[model samples]
Target: MRAQIGDRLVLEGTHLGDARRVGIVIAVAHDDGSPPYEVRWLDTGRATLIFPGPEARIESQPPVADVSGPA
Candidate 1:
């Protein structure tokens, strides 16, 4: 899957009772946004380079809403 920096990498648990893992894409290895991303895991607060498997999916950053009043 493709991802950009700041996107979240969610690795779904393969077995029952296993917790899913989530991480942020701190770096992208390819210009086209392909995998082999450097992720900073939320739970462990550690970074690692990963060639994500089938269980992995990318969660893009949500759009930022304008907080300021309309001008």
Candidate 2:
């Protein structure tokens, strides 16, 4: 798995009826965009280093630009 800063990590529940967890990639630990990313959980706003498992998936967002002014 690979990710960049600002990518969203979705962690599916292990068992039935478990609550899903969502986090954002705050920092990438490796140069190759590998695992062990520093993520901040949306639920609690807490940050931690995580090695994602099979239940985890990443949602990469496109770069944002200033669209307020005329093109």
lDDT of 1 at 2: 91
State, as a TM-score between 0 and 1, how close model 1 is to the true structure: 0.85
Question: Compared with the true structure, what per-residue lDDT tens digits does model 1 show for residues 1-71?
Answer: 89999999999999999999999999999999997999999999999999999999999998778999899
Clashing pairs in 1: none
Off by over 4 Å in 1: 63-71
Worst 10 residues of 2 by lDDT: 62-71
Residues 1-71 of candidate 2: C-alpha lDDT, one tens digit per residue: 99999999999999999999999999999988899999999999999999999999999989999889986
Model 2, position 33, has a per-residue lDDT of: 87
